[model samples]
Target: MAMAVPAQTIAGYDRFPWDAILLQTNSALMNNTDPNVWASQIISTLRSTAVTLPSVDLAHRLVSHLFWNHHSPIAWKLLDIAASLNLLPPLLLVALLSTRIVPMRKVYPQAYRLYLELVKQYVLMLQFRNNSPNYEMIMESIDNVLQLSQVYSHKVCEPGVALVEFVFSILWQLLEAILDDEGLLDHVPENKPRWLSRSHDMDIAEHDCINEMKTEQKEGMQRKNTMIAIEIIVQLLQNKMTSRLLCLVHRNMPSYWGSFNHQMQLIASKSSILKNLKHITADTLLSLMENIHGVVSCNTKSKLESNVVIPAGSQIAFGGQCEGSSWSSIWLPIDLILEDALDGGHVAALSAIEIITGMNV
Candidate 1:
């Protein structure tokens, strides 16, 4: 408000005072004597005081000083600036993954784009993750992704969902493995599976993939290690567990606009992923079908995981209530694949996954 008060005045606020500068420069605004003007006055004083400093941490100070106390659209504008400056915490990570953002969404003409902004944030996280920086950056990025996933679960677009699943799945897998090795499984997430420790547990009998080794040789060792990673994922997705979770979430979703939480739930299942054979189907699936209103168009399980990339042609379109009437269900070579019900939720979720994974396959 005070001519975007410069940083130099910040350090010297109490001396020459930016408030005086504002009183002189913005005499009209100062005349009102509104209490809201206090922030402006203080900032002006800060500018005059800080006029000598070479640079300033305006963004960091903004949140601590102003936005924390009085959040508003204007305050968010400062945050947007900080986000551009790599200052603000990633807020809409799930949004970016959905291909629902500005530039990326603009590229995909026909695919459903809902939460691209969140997914963009996710892409940043992945890039940072793959860059293999310090533990803090990786952890921060994963935290942001998980946070976005939870925050935007109901808002996810089906087409963008697989991408989200892929990114979060990989991160979760890595985190689980790390925690397990460190004896911190209970400290992290409890559902992780297929470790050397729990072979006889019947509660997860179906998720025996991680513990089984084809051989102990070098090649077998590599294969077995990757399998272990996938197994951890499967446990998270146990017993039609992912699909069941998706069904529960789809109920509250606003019909077609929602994300693929259901499909993510399905993807979380390891048996459904590795074996590609339906070992078990829930009886309550009928109720799940009723709720989704879309048929279990296909029940084929997937066999891909973190290292095993989703094949180039694996992605398929999902048509929900919009099926038959408006949206035509077509099979395209999408980078993402949905193993859930042929509904809106899964389709959107795949798009998000694509964005985060940055995988064309």
Candidate 2:
């Protein structure tokens, strides 16, 4: 018979070098002269451990200091390393999503690019994990992004647009991954019509049986996760800030809008919980159009009457008049112009005008 090992000895064998590894990594991050080399070392160490040490807080603080002090590339490199380890602390994620980064995107585009890459890595890491302990952190980060969008709304700057776009992309990716993993894409078969007997009681019993089956399915863990994801998306859609951000994205980024629209259509068509998303999407688009009409109407009202003069040597003619010297030009009202532009198969023209006017249509 083999000798029995002491309980303390077995416990020691199971223990990892959490403190030693974290200390050495923190020291390397702090004192290493070359950021690239240190980043490589950090990545190697994290991969070897295969666990996110709570002591990664030291690395988090160091990255925050670098980010604030204008060494964002290095900061982002460190963040990438952390994200690969799935060690992004909740507080750090919230900090990165803060409103403070809005201006940085414009002033330091390269650093901003690095920041985006870091965020993408974090999202990928989250997606790879099935049971993410950082779910609450991710949710808080979403709220932080929403808050940043709200703050950016008040500013008259282009930087906010990039921030809003980034937020929308990240939120969509994270939620889509969660929804996909939870099997929200699985087709829910429609309840078959039962053969009705002459008696009404039979019909009632059949309906009751269908309802019970439906309830049982809805109560499963997968269904619960799917519902939670749908609820989160719906809540975001209802939020004025996030909704406005998405509307702006829809108006500006056609490629992104097309892909996002396709995803929304998939969700609406496939998932029972997201059936109302189609209606919400329509309402959001209508609201965005109205907002465009209001802004364009206000800005162009004064310019419309004064600037109606047709340029000299122009081929264009209004109301069947060709090349006349200042024939009393009839001005089209803003509503009619919008109706003609939006309803008369000239949506491309309206989008161009919105872009030119910088009204975020």
Candidate 3:
């Protein structure tokens, strides 16, 4: 019989090969001609590892190194590998979120395509109920992506349009999920509970405190996500990409818009989302108007029935001494489109104008 190796000795032996493989992988990542092949080899090695080390950690390290080095080709190849393996490691996601497009575009002309792919993978991961190790970390990564997009909106290229669309869709779905879970549509309680005894009151107080903390935390996250969504919309409008943006909203409006609008109303009622909305410049609004007119004109020329409609009774009422209601509703996009068509003096705009005028009359 062959002699059994000592556990410590076997572990030491195992560490050497892994270390060597890691070193080789790093070196190869820098100069590999075929990134997919290199990525495949790295992934195979990682999956083949028999040790107790987590695969995600290894993935994180590789992604972190590729990002730090600005290795776009290899980084994208790794992303493809990760997607194929259905492994969306939070660390890798964070690294992708933090990678700035300006720098990557300077290095690689195809950076936008890679970024789009990353966004697509993020959307897929979010849509599917994968067993992500940490849901909070994934959410944080998404927040980072949104923040990054807002900061770099001016630098957005053609491919980045798709990225924004995917990001917005994901945000809408996430908001819907949050609202469905919390039942935010229900009426708030008006009265406080009375205690039966001092000890009982103390226990109830403690429980209330914990519950309040949890609610506050969830509310904070909702506020942040809402702000990011608004920022993205504003940025897209500023970039003169409103037509495509409107198209995306129109497509998803039927299924998610009601819940999404309700959530937005709740957010605006409590937070600074409305304040931010007030700051949108007139020029941006005019640009959005022009884009909407173009969309309406095209629909008329093609004889297509437009599904876009600024639903009636979508007024937003502000709290406490705010006398008049505002048009800062979540359905503001529809309102903009209608305003454009009614005001635009073109034959193509006539049909839409008549429809709205008849509805109001």
Candidate 4:
């Protein structure tokens, strides 16, 4: 199970001001103190078994000094050293960097890209354990990442396509991690017959009980994962991010859409949030279709080749009803586009006019 190291409070110094230490560190750097010296000392103290680490808030303030003073080479060196020693908390780093990304982006494009890469690496290192007991921390970390993506997407543009793509990739990983836990429950061994287990029946019985408890825990986790998945999907829709994300996928990852949609559908079905699933899904598809129409119309008016690439398998067909839920009428235009794409080699403009006309009708 992946778990964050809890912050440790120092005895007799519970109210120690971290700002003073940061100021001292900065003063030391100005006096030409080797960054390795001060950086190593701080990191060592944090890792020491005998000493206590500061509270979470103070810890963040101390570590964030490096990010806030990123103009100094000393700060970057310290961050590199901390990351090397696995002492840097991924969530804290993400929060700090993401909040300041707008200015960093404008002032230092190269540093912005490098720090964003580091952030991506840190996020990938985070994984939710099966039946982890640290629910609050894990959920907070997830929420932080979601908010980080929103900030990055909204504030950073121009050289921001890579950042956008990274957001989608991490979101997919988070969803997949949840799905993997659900997959584990399906393979749990059935109980052995009591008659056939006489010799080791006591141990067997205890094992069975443990397994039963684990199964129940996993079921509860599944419910929570479902709600999280719904939140992710809804945010993507509300921000209109999925359409651009699909274009990125189409250009570089043609095969992912199939499984991505399946994951979305499975997650939706598992939660009460699915009550408006059809409406939400329709709105998402309609937005994408409308964007496609506009792109095609522009290209046609200019008699230029279109730059749009439709996501492979974006044209999925649905019945009048799926399970008990009725398909929304808004899906009709999207369905026509899907049918034409399946037959016409996934061409972006092939049925765009017809679909738009159908929508108007």
Candidate 5:
């Protein structure tokens, strides 16, 4: 029945006492106050304060407490607010990635968008070429990405997933070469086609390596991280491009909505991207498909770890049953190709036939 005290009102007399604010917030949480009330209060306080915001370390600690204590929406929102003000700490963004505070559900688009905002800022700040300041954070992100891939293999739309298979593929080859050199494959991932294994054993054989070798290894990792970052940007660019095309088409030809997909398919078939792929080997194509399959297919052998932690005195009970869909029997591409063939698109049909026959080889 009591109204929540505004954080700005609380701080109006005082010069932004973060410790007191934290204590009050904890008390409010313990007393079972609505998360939104406290979140609004915090955001208002941060935005309207005349004094300096909390230091990077202090802000990270505050956000971590906020995240661990109650609902994640508040935590995610606070991070976004901090990021907009350019007050977000690198570690806080890293924590966001590790915790995945924003659930990867289509319904929670705003929360996920805020999550990406923080991630993009952190990524832009990273200079992957040199000895980066946020090396630990970078490595932590990579580890979390691998962990997430194993847990949510069927959820390809999860952030950083596009790079998962490619990164692992390279790591697998690197490990393989090292093992071959050392004459032992003693501790490897459980499955064959090692890149798709339930987990990877990344411990390299110790060697009396020169300083240059160590430097080279570090540079290699930096390059790998750079590639992953670039891929994330590329995916964003592709999405933007599709939206732009859709807008242009919708604006110019309102009646084209009926056959939009058909037109798009035709355009793609004749696109220079496909036509210029004259040197793509069957093995390369098969590997690319296999990588995609590995990403989107659920591996029964892998266990999904629970990241949910219930704080003390929190009576909140979490439970849910997900109705998993059955895997489709047909590949949609094959059906589309068949339709193209039947529709008398001779050139496109011939291209499809060549690709399929090459796959059979």
Candidate 6:
């Protein structure tokens, strides 16, 4: 808020050209001249990527402009220029900024360069290895914040207003970093392993907060690199980057799985994604029930070969054993009364009678 807006200008990295375009775009929006058209062209420019291109800088710039617009009115004008020139931001970058945790070395070397150069303080690299769906739910929360009435009532968060997407992206970063590296934020003990730390995440109440909240922005890459962390998290999940996240979450918070259990119930209730995932829910529930039952009853491991993600289109088998045609449960031993009880104590005569009749009831 302290920095005054500057004259519109163009800025570009070695690969992507965007700083100049953003200035033009913001000028159009602020001046109320063809804002919608400029917005449309910006999105179009991004979508029509020349797949032949070597780097993602232009794409980065176009999207970056969205966040830079409010602080730098000139950047907004530059975004319009990028749109007019058919330049695009990176899709992967947008996705990274969405909800998953990503490492800087893997996702954004350019940004990482800036982080290392401008930030003399050493930064730790940590991965919160729990790949649990709670992170996915966290993403859903972020999406909701973007669509809040005060922010946007549209069905989905759209591009045009860079600030809106930029803000939402920041929320995701806060969640990822807090979940992965809370120590950096001064909220958790720096000596503790990063995965053990956590911070308050974005919520419904915050979504409804006033515009002044924008004035309360945090310092440096914290704002810009928020989505990058999340996008990596998503990439890991999609690519099944399982272990790191698992170790981070489960090892630190064993009970975190308990929270995942609740997600099954929550998702099943009219959430379309959950509605279609009933089988996974059932299998997860079955496994938990079986695991707990075994530990309680036998006082040890289940020894049962049940897996978490069930094989496709298979039901939970009530009867054990792999009999192809027919299977039966072995009857339990029981003592019968009547004459047999008396005969056991007594009777050589009864034994002889049963031997002759071939009946041992």
lDDT of 3 by residue, 1-361 (tens): 0011222322544564356556656666566535456556654554444422224445455555554354445555555554444444533453443344312321222343344334333432222222333433443344344443343232322222223333444444333322333444342221311111122112211112224345655455445444443444444333323443444443333233334444545534433343555565434434443453234344332322345443442122111221112212233232333333343232231222112221110
Q: Output the lDDT of residue 109, model 3.
A: 23
Q: Of the candidates shown, which would achieve the greatest TM-score relative to the real structure? A: 4
TM-score of 5: 0.27
* Residue-by-residue lDDT tens digits, candidate 6, 1-361: 0111222322443332243345556666576554456656544433333322212344454444443223233333333233223332222233322322223222222233232221111111111111322322322333443333233223432121222233323323333343443223332223442222222221113212223233333222343333333333233222211222222222222343334333323322323332244234434433432343222122111222333232222111122331222222421111110112222232122211112221110
Comparing candidate 1 with candidate 4, which one achieves the higher TM-score? 4
Which run of 10 residues does model 6 get worst, by summed lDDT?
331-340
Q: How badly does each model clash, as a count of residue pairs?
A: 71, 0, 0, 0, 0, 42
Candidate 6: give its CA RMSD in angstroms. 27.9
Give the Cα RMSD of candidate 3.
Answer: 20.6
What is the model-wide C-alpha lDDT for candidate 3?
A: 0.38
> lDDT scores for all predictions?
0.32, 0.38, 0.38, 0.38, 0.33, 0.30
Between prediction 1 and prediction 3, the one with superior lDDT is 3
What would the TM-scores of all predictions be?
0.22, 0.30, 0.33, 0.34, 0.27, 0.25
Q: For candidate 1, what is the TM-score?
A: 0.22
Which parts of model 1 are misplaced by more than 4 Å? Answer: 1-68, 87-263, 266-361
Q: Distance (Å) between predicted and true CA of 47, model 6?
A: 14
Angstrom error at residue 196, model 3: 55
